[model samples]
Target: MSDKRPLLDTSDIESEKDGIMGAKESSLLMTGITYKSTTVAPTVVWYGRQLLVRRKLFVGLLVVFIFSYFLIGPADVLDLDNVDSIVQVHHQSNVLDREVNQKLLLPKGYLVYSNQCRIVDLDPYKREVMRHFKRVSYKPCKQRLPLTQMRYDDHTRRYVLSINSTAFQSYHVKNVLSCCYMGVERVSESNVSYTHCEHFKSKAQISNTTDSVIVKCSTEKGQIYINGHATIPERLQIRQRLKQWKRRDQGRRVPSVLMIGIDSISRVNLIRAMPKTAQYLYDNDWFELAGYNKIDDNTFPNIMALMVGYNLSNAMKYCNPYVSGGLDKCDFVWKLYKKHGYVTSYGEDAVKINTFNYLKKGFKQPPVDYYLRPYLSAAEKLLDGNVVLGLPHCLGFETESEHVYNYALEFARRYRNDSFFGFFWTNTHSHGDISQTSSMDDYLKDYLQRLLAQGTLEHSIVVFFSDHGLRFGPTRSTWSGHLEERLPFLFIWLPPFLRAERPEFVKALRENRNRLTTPYDLHMTLKHILTLSGRTGKLETLDGAKDCPQCQSLLLPVPLNRSCEDVAIEDHWCTCWSYKAINKNSKTMRHLGERVVHYLNDYVTSFRNGSLAHLCQPLTLQGISAAYKARLSDDDPSQTQIYWLTFSTAPNQALYEATVRYNKSSTSEDNVQVTGSVSRLNSYSGEADCMNDFAIKKYCYCHHKSG
Candidate 1:
């Protein structure tokens, strides 16, 4: 025992360093033998080397996969850069059925017809029939188009030209329905007061004088029930009211030029509202010297057409408003007085904020010295006595109408002596706060009467119109407004200076000038008034009118006969767009861009009809509100797209489903969050049973109790 204790010397030092378990194991092994133990070191392994050997396959595969995604994947598709070139297969064409005519939504009076003529089917005459002159509708077809059909029509003949202007017997497709007269009343010797005409049995008065003229018109398309459900005429009735209107205007002097700028306006309503405005504009004493015709009923395109002497779908786009030369850019009127070099102005609040933006691309700032820019500078350039085509904003609510009126009056008073070219007034006074601007119509009548008394509209050709109709409906709400808001009133006053060409010109204009006109025809109308003949949209610019391209307006609408033999299917193989074609041959993803543009063009229509239905569909909003709230709260914007789909309420079958896989920055487990959205092109209720399907099968067989 004494020897063992003595041997427990410095050995304990190394013993302590090693674990007690290791020392015991060593002692146990050395127990029976003569132990000659010594401390020794063992070799260790590097983690990097071992790791490389153990996961060599995984590392190699990951690198190859990443390289494949960025490099090889692109090569496999059409070789291209950006979204347009990526080889994406759209298996379904955007072809549609039961398509509605766009003209149906256009402002009232506008119409669309086929450009081709065919033989009357039911008629035994088998004579050349131009059903093309009627409004667009499904009709039976039996035309074996002759070789002459290959030829393009003249540009000036672009209007729904009839093989026979009054082919009443060839009423192959009768769209003409009832016609209406606008509400009008002479408020003064020179001015007029107007309102919408609710009934056909109303007396009206108008005059041509040095003061302002006003007109108002209104109409609605609704089922006319006899007792309760028995409806009157199903289609619109085209009364022979044009003849009466001609008689009213025949004795008057139409303004040399009339400027109509409907704030947030469309074309159809303009047609219904035109009679009152027209009667006032052409009253005997005004510029009545007019030789003008109307083009189409659309406003923006019509105006542009009137300005540029080309169709809305003109091949050489861009109506460079500032340009002085070239027949292509300038309408006949502008071409006539390019040297007059008058400025254009938009002092009236009528110019929509987005108007200029839509006119030019990336116009975060105004386009410098642009052709339309002159419309903004017209009031300033009176010294040189230049021709001016000017429009000023008619802002309200913030600014008093009287103040704006007086301000404009001051400007006109100063510039009356100049040989002015053109003018457009916003007419803010016509707008209503029927609740606030003066509850009583008498108040507005009197206020307007006072303005007339001031006699400021003494000299110039004047025309008045509202871009919209009253917001009032059957029921009254403060927030109540018209669906496609329009203020339908236009008045015009013209001076004696342009009076030289009155006799013959006034007669033609008195008979036909007020027909359906596009805003594009405004320039054409002005030119004709200036005694310069040109054709454009048939309006003032008849001298500058041009043709639309063949492919655009031509639609192969489904037929009424419903015979498979009646339907013609042509080769669509040439329509197959190859990846190379998109990448190299096409213009800026030509095919893809066109589809996108079409989708955009048609998307708004869904909102006007389908989306509204979905939104107001008592069940949809109640069912999906939770989902929408959840979706909108998301920090990511992409999540909202799905929410939109839900709000759109697209049916399961209607929705076009797509799944995109992307690598994320997380080094954790793979997870996916399901989302939803509806089509912008078409509206439908989008629903699902299993949202988080591991497989992106967009189909659903179950429905949750709505919300």
Candidate 2:
């Protein structure tokens, strides 16, 4: 029931790397530059025409320029502040690709940017400069602190954890030594090194507890464990806790469930975590898919995709946000049980992943625009049960990890009833700051070991998994590659009654123990676990939930509101109020497509309101005529011979932001805007080569040429 994995001695390994597993998985670990958001300065240099011959070359150029400025100027006057004024801010595709890069630039919330800045997007496909400013200030979050990397390979014997502090005040924050495995024994330590934890530097006793075998520390918040050898329970204590509840014997049907999460679980990792969880549940179970993916290829869209049953696809344009479930149309599943009389609670960090709508239960454009209410799914805006919840994760740099986990543990301890469901979630301490799975696994194993010992994991079906796997780092190896999609885990611990009915599933498990499975079947799986399998019926066990070879539907749900609405609807269906758009035949944006245009108006106002447009009118008199305002084709324009004739500028100089307004034929008078910015790369002496040095690939150069 426990592992005897050997301790990873770091004496011979360099301090540079804490612990690197075999080279195969080690590819994802590394330490790199710290990021910060700062200010950008405008760099506009004017070159006066030197020769007299240049003057006589154009006639009445002033009049023509005057008119052009006025025409394009009006579009500039419209901005985000006014975008909502004339336009309905409904979503196109709920997918949020452009997560604000707050680390690189300070945030001013929704509608703002730098003054000298040319509105520019961080697009890299064109082989041309994409950044907007030449002199932007950067302020790091904290002073550069010493970073420590350590790895532990522990199993049912000695519990171990690595301890390193950052300069941040939180890094100084350590756990209280309240508990440890009684059977735990620290063997030996040859290489013990410390350089002052960068974050917790002010503390007197830097190393709270260190012996030749291990190290320990005590801070105000909670207990911290480090690298050692240890043993964990074969079954969790959740079942043991459930026994204390009077409702267990009072219940005629399955009433309570737990959703455990295994961060970044994948097809590969599932093989590792699931069977173990399943065996635990095999004895006694009550839980579901802690994490799931609707489509297997896109990791960022996994969370959002799980509710509905589809991928958000390329619609996530700007930057991928963590656990972005808004990337697609989906609804919360708890609604079903809430209607059937069940209480639900979340004991995880604030779900900041849906920054645009975290508090909104991170609502997506479910087949129906509906929110999950505390009340049963049957009633609108009603409470199904008294609930205990925590702040949703805005999901970024703030270190609230321990808080999120402890919150879940606390809630579970408080409300272990027969009619409730609770989820404990996490995303950080995974990617962003720390970048090692083995390192992550190293800590998680020890934590589980302790929690299991506390009798926190038992009888209850423990569900664990992650939104998706992490991309090691920005790499040449990641060109639309699917590495980010394939590896996530879906470990489940189910009780006997649960698996007895799902024979096919049991067969799948008993067969190879090694095969590919994704969250593609999650919606059905979760519903099955929640006992709200709709037409699929409650599964008796993992053996019953398996896809029967003859089963055609596999119990997958159709669109939510597919009943009487006659208006044409596609893919998933919904009967919620949002689906009224379907009834009224209202325009619906696809994967943030409408969202893209809705914001264009903001950029437009900035342009039209600024004096730049009014003064540049002569160039276009009325801007590019509506007739010539053509849509940008997918082909890379710079590579086209036509691009050389259409616009003329040396390479790139002062970041130029031009805004144009157009409406798609489908929606007349509704304006869409496109904003462009060219990076000011180098010193502009006289003239520079406009064509970049590298083409097609990302590391290319493009600048102005003046001879």
Candidate 3:
């Protein structure tokens, strides 16, 4: 081996100790090559140990880099801050895919009308109509020298009627304050009689007395000094009823139902007229029925559909308001609630044109346990009030609608601990002019806020809704108004408890917003509320509407392909079908207009056994003003083209709007038929004075006036 462990050179030892040397020298030393040897071995075994140490160090660094790259993730390793952003991007992509699928599944023209009839707040036509009604600052009537004040004492659980002595002192008159309990007596189905006056003591516990009372202060000379009306809510009775119900139905939880209704206000009009209230409802997560279509022309039939779940013909046959006690036989939803140990109440403003009593005999008996008609009637009769917008605006230093709201608030407060059903409607502000709806925006918003703050909505199902839109006005002529007139505002709120317990129902409600809905659906929803229980479980089966068997609870999903016929909505009132302008001068439009005019004339002639044929002048189409052809949906295979015509008739130059359906598939002469009743677009006040039939009056032009 020639001494493999040869003597180490002094310079090699010094260089190795210093860790510095030329590559060849270090290699020669490590490889054990002799300093005198000029040839070196190709394999350097001595340096293998040093090379292995370096290889291990490099492998350790490589492992650490791989471990760190995976541990921190590629985004983090690349110093990017979009980890959550990436997740959000995926989530948005999934949502978009879902929406696209939904759109693909929807039938054509499903929401076309809604998309086309978007009414902006500052629409030129609406603004022009608004100009007719000058903006008047709202001023609450000054409180008169108070004669009486009714309040509930929470601690005492009794209502206290306080006599205000200020009226006597301020007027410098001495009088005896005498109060009499005024009880409502249903003498007949169409009539109500107030009970004989019974002496009542002032500042006395009137909780046991009737709900309303008449108070009068007389001078010594027997001259009436002050007269006022007071309403005493029966809180004690409500509590008792609740206690009995709780015992009878233990562990069953039912939400209190409160409905606040406005007349002639549409979905978009509500937003335009009452922006604050709409925004408040939006912020509070109220579920809005975007496609709630009216079933009839005006409030009466529409409200009847909601309360009685009956269509016009069925309602007339079953719940004839003209017939004595007919409405009593009608299955009003509130009666169901009342039977189930819930305190029920009904109130409305605009006494003359009130929903139930407008030219129709209202309920003969007090429909609800707490009725507001008597008090409102007494107030309107006894109190000094002023008319605004063709209706009583104020009664005794308070707005007419304010009385209804106040009564509703008191009723809600009184029955806060009890299960109750209350329907309060106000028409004084919104019934006549659409612009007047703005006057009630702040007040209505405040009322809703108070309901929330006072905890009335804690366990309540509140519905803030409307009947229909502007029935007759400049706004009605606009395309937006045509859609808005049918799509009234319908917003519903479910309590937190119910929302958490019945998530499926809430989900269905949210989904039904875009589906075509009607008052019949609302009727089923009310019925569904009666079935809810305290325990978390599935909802019970609900009965469908009388007229519309397919109409179910709005708390349940409404079919996307549901049409006007599905929900018992007439073609005249249905806004689901999209419309496009057609040339009025076109021959087809002219023929359609003539057919519509002839339909109206025939409608008038057919009434009362054709007795009015001579009394009413035959209507001839003067000209077609505006014509639109309906864009049929894909599901409709009948090939029935619906044409909406706004045309003038001769003799009266009366403008009439009618919906005529022309069946292209039919070979019969009756292929063209009027879908529904004709709408009198102009004032037919004096033109149809010869006819007493309200339906015939729209089309009948008096023969005497024709000359």
Candidate 4:
């Protein structure tokens, strides 16, 4: 038989010997083909070269295609469309139906004629409203005045008062709310107790004579100052109550929860300001929810959403916490934990503008087992007047942020053996002006690191978060900033044991790392935590309701395809991109603006039935400020138009943005048919006041004074 196997020449043999070719590779040196070790060897040139050319051409074509793709196809792929649109469009206007003012609904005892006043002028109206203030014995107020400290002195037969008065304190005491008073009652006697009270004044007299009087000293407003804790008998009763509480919580196996929050910080800003800190958290088994969004525009409403598991608007006619009896009787989430034997604590730095009491009365007594208000009150009283206006207002002796950190740390340390729930929020570093929040990043990170190292959070569910992004700054004008306003940072650290035991949960959490989440979802998660207690220690799988209308627990699987409307976010504040605006002066744009104004007026009228509803003249279009076209999703081809319009109503003008959707078949020449009803995006009410140039500059045109 003829030998059909390919023969290797000396060069092929050498190539094989040099490990350049295996037996199969050396087979190419057949039929006049010779393979060398390095140089391009003579192959069956006609056929081999043809194959080689084809392979090279294919690769060359791919390279060129990829290069072209990177050059032309990526022109605006990464560029944010909104940023360009913001720069391209300048002017748009809104036309709204005139609003008529009926009778203004005032809080009981409030004498202001119009409820729209931003800041009340108290000097002229104090006497008129004081008589209407009825004193009702509610919970004791834990807040302390800046200068006042009261300690009952048995030997002196009086409560000793030491105060360092400041201008702010003087203003707060005399002008704001009800004046302070001091009263005393015997610990034993309920009916016949001697009470002596006086309005807080810089020059109030106190009789410190040598007379034996055994009574508990407290404020007429039910506030107990730092030095004025309950008497010995009252202390005994409290201890007894605590003992009863301990017995009630006996044998329970609830895990602790620690929540630390900063105010007015967006997730984007947090990452920008504290990249190292953000990374450290992710590296330390803490999961970040990138899509965590604020439920409301401000802190109170967002907090109420998280604490109560409900929409802020549903709870009250207005978004303000103070409008509906102030959260004193709101039955917050902490109360649920407290009922279940958890030692709950609620504290926030910054006393005067305390969110729960802003423009409203605060809680009467300690809302939680460890209330930080009184402690903060004491610290503020001791801080120097000059330093109070600046950063690091003294908390005890430390800065306000430091003090809050330490308080939370110490509480966690003290309650390591017990089930506890503690929430500490500090606005001292990041409240109204977020310029200084970057400075706080290091301190906050270091504190959290220390907590992690100390294993203080070993058995606890820890949450680090913020309320919302900055609302009042030049940044707010940018498209990124506008979206950032609704996106808050949320990071949760689950215990290793729990995570390991429930791999499904770990998977769900990992999946939800980029899913849309809100404060109401947090409330539901907290409810899940409540169910994790008891000796059985049975942890139910997280509620996996994909399209929960009200709330969804973090342990649950949130659907990848969820809309803001499905999550209870109103159209005005929904951050989801959905609308695109038409041309600035297009007839369609003008009609859309008019429709938005009429819609807003009708919605406002629905809520406000009295004279308060009709407070302004009919809105007329000044100009269209900007417009955008929104694509619902990558797969959705239909687009909706959104317009930001400046509207003037007699003496006042405001900026309102609205989204309008038109049928795809409707042509510009034809009367456009509405595909969906017009929805208002947001309304900047005080933006374009005719009287204020700053407001006009921000939201209205100062040149259009005649309009």
Better of 1 and 3 by lDDT: 3
Global Cα lDDT for candidate 2 = 0.29
What are the root-mean-square deviations of the candidates from the true structure over C-alphas?
A: 33.7, 25.4, 23.9, 22.1
Best-first order by lDDT: 3, 4, 2, 1
User: How many residue pairs clash (N, CA or C atoms closer than 3 angstroms) in each of the candidate models, in the order given?
Assistant: 79, 127, 2, 30
Looking at model 1, residue 143 earns an lDDT score of 22
Best by lDDT: 3
Candidate 2, superposed: residue stretches over 4 Å from native:
1-255, 262-300, 310-330, 347-399, 433-442, 450-457, 475-481, 496-505, 511-516, 532-707
Whole-model Cα lDDT of every candidate shown, in order: 0.26, 0.29, 0.70, 0.52
Candidate 3, which segments miss by more than 4 Å at Cα? 1-135, 143-145, 154-158, 164-202, 218-232, 235-241, 533-542, 608-618, 634-637, 664-667, 686-694, 701-707
TM-score of each: 0.31, 0.35, 0.76, 0.58
Poorest stretch of ten by lDDT in candidate 2: 574-583
Name model 4 segments beyond 4 Å from true.
Answer: 1-253, 317-326, 378-382, 385-397, 535-550, 578-582, 598-608, 611-620, 633-707
For 1-707, candidate 2 gives per-residue lDDT tens digits of 01111111122123113222322132322212123433332321111222222333332343443453342231121121222112111111132124312222322210112221111111111111101101112222233332222222224312233333453344554443322211121221111233232232222221213211222334566543222211111123333433444343354435255565534443322222232333333233222221122232223345534433333432233222223443333234555444444445543332333222332223223211111111111111111112112222211111234435544454344344344465555543443311222223433445555545544453344556666543322221121111222334455544454456554543333221112223435544565655532222445532221221111112232221121112111111111111000111123222122333233223323442542222111111111100111122234233211000011122222211122333444353444433221111122223313311111111112221222
Model 2 TM:
0.35
Task: Quote model 3's TM-score.
Answer: 0.76
Q: Which of the two candidates, 1 or 4, achieves a greater lDDT against the reference? A: 4
What is candidate 1's TM-score against the reference? 0.31
Sort by TM-score, best first: what order?
Answer: 3, 4, 2, 1
How well is each residue in 462-538 modelled by candidate 4, as lDDT tens digits? 98998887665544533445566777888888887677666666666666665677888888788777777652233
